[model samples]
Target: MVTAAIGLEFVKQFLNLNNPPEFVFACCRDPATATDLKEIVKSNSSVIIVELDVTKQESVEKAKSHVASIVGTKGLNLLINNSGLINSQRIGDVTREDMLKCYEVNAIGPLMVAQAFLPLLRQAAGQQSSEPMSCSKAAIINISSGVASITENSSGGMYPSRASKAALNMITSNLSLDLKTDGILCTAINPGWVKTEMGGPNALITTEESVEGIMSVLEKLKGEEDSGRFYHGVKGQTIPW
Candidate 1:
């Protein structure tokens, strides 16, 4: 599932693939206001607009039910927790509310969504014939950031964003272990410094570049060996988490 901006680009890229998925659920906080996403999928029947608010448990559960009704026994192949929040507050300026809100959106949201939709993912895994774990069968990919890496924290800022994302990385690792027996792969990926609204125009790469590299890395992920690792979106290399 996804939101607008970078998430919208991912939806577009998936549709453009040579052999696209049977269904592309373009999830957002408010589907009515998601004009861009609507426009992109206007002519396509495969893309379904799902109203989802990552920060709200009710919204997440509702979206899960909606998706379950559609996919039915076939199940969902992949779950992408691409929703995120970034606060500009630094160490001295950040408040409890700031940290809580950031944690709610960036870390807890994905965890709730994963918990709700895990049945479908496990169903998909059981149905697929592939012996090795793969995205085509079942996977949970959390969109993380390099700033979450304690070893790579040379610039020390974005206190809320960093801490919450670090929590998300830990969540990803825990899921990887917990879901391994179920034949599900879980990984945290840093989509580089993409030129999105959050990444800013001064960022090193474009959304297309980031998404492209992300797709490449995901395509190569296989079995237990590749799961529970943090990856660099553009470079397709493991990040220091």
Candidate 2:
């Protein structure tokens, strides 16, 4: 719901395309909380909401099946591994379970989604109509964080959040290399400090602004240019590993 409400809204308004791209929102909770999303589906029949627990492989597979049924064999053109969790605990305060939970959602979740959806992404890349202008390339965007960049203890706590994002960046880079031949582009984006529930009240940007910036990055994506790079949202620059 958050992705659809914040991320896709920016994509829809900023892109200004003739038609809105179909969207599938996968969540672990009940879809009823997404009242705004439900309204979007009412207006645009192409939107789908499915139950998905990214931490579990079974849940991911079920969600994939549901999406496949909706979009048919054409498959997904874009996959955004945006689902994540943050546990704010200092090094000594952090527990083993907390660290594991963070890794499950932020690192392993994206990897599972990528592996499960590879065929769909490949299908989208190979899609060609009798008219060449109708085809579109496939892409994957993984939401990473600035914590992944530095090893400093400036933040004090939040070890789980920091480590998971770093792991996510590594996953993104590896996936990009593996999927390059298949014409699937994968890149990690640090969406900057935005005032989401996770970003807290002192965040620098609004969720809308951050999403707009990320969408700008997404729009400029070209097959030859940025596939495996780590993007910094605020400066719109690439971050080196």
Candidate 3:
């Protein structure tokens, strides 16, 4: 799976894996300021750092160019949309600016990234021509949330995060339909309440646990019909939409 440096958990998992030869491109906005991310780079030679700002078209196009150069004939097997924005604001207390900004990053950013990298995904599918005619194709894993679930909103607060994630789900569903013809698989995953900056210290899962579960999901999931499905990060269980 191609995981971005939204959190180093996925990166850490990829680095430690003793599996088949799958390239991991750690795309982010600024590698220079990413001290923790840079430190991870010191240990691994396969990880390629490409500058990407998913919120901006120009930055994504530039990043696509850089990744394309690196991935010449091979193309990309997976594109992981892990970058997210969370604005903790109550419904009445939320500012207009924060609401829009949340949607821009959480919802729209993934769309832009997927659009920019589609050709590369197609290339990867073509490269695997000898494989069986299965739905196990090029994939895009979107790090979505349980908060976005309209069926499970018991507390009903986090307006910005909830709304933006819901929008992201819509994008994922449409993307699956739109890209399936090209043998591209697209799906959304809720990483659960992990102890990250956004998930906070009291959360149930650790980054390691979350990443482990996510990796399993990417490895085992199958079929084009499975694309656009919302998966709970724990053991790739199907979540109710």
Global Cα lDDT for candidate 2? 0.73
What's the lDDT for candidate 3?
0.80
Residue 42 miss distance in model 3 (angstroms): 2.6
Summarize candidate 1's per-residue lDDT along 51-162 as a digit string, tens digits: 9998889999999999999999999999999988888788889999999999999999999999999999999999975579999999999999988999999989899999
After superposing candidate 3 on the true structure, give the runs of residues whose Cα lies further than 4 Å from its correct spot. Answer: 1-6, 20-22, 129-136
Q: Order the candidates by lDDT, highest first — what do you get?
A: 1, 3, 2
How high is each candidate's TM-score? 0.98, 0.87, 0.92
Put down candidate 3 lDDT per residue, 133-206, tens digits, no spaces.
Answer: 23235777889999988888889888999999999998999998987777788889999888877777899988
lDDT to native, each model: 0.93, 0.73, 0.80
Which 10 consecutive residues of model 3 have the lowest summed lDDT? 128-137
- Please tell me which predicted candidate would have the highest TM-score against the true structure: 1
Model 2 misplacement above 4 A: 1-16, 22-28, 128-136, 151-156
Q: Go through the candidates in order and give the C-alpha RMSD of each one to the true structure.
A: 0.9, 3.3, 2.2
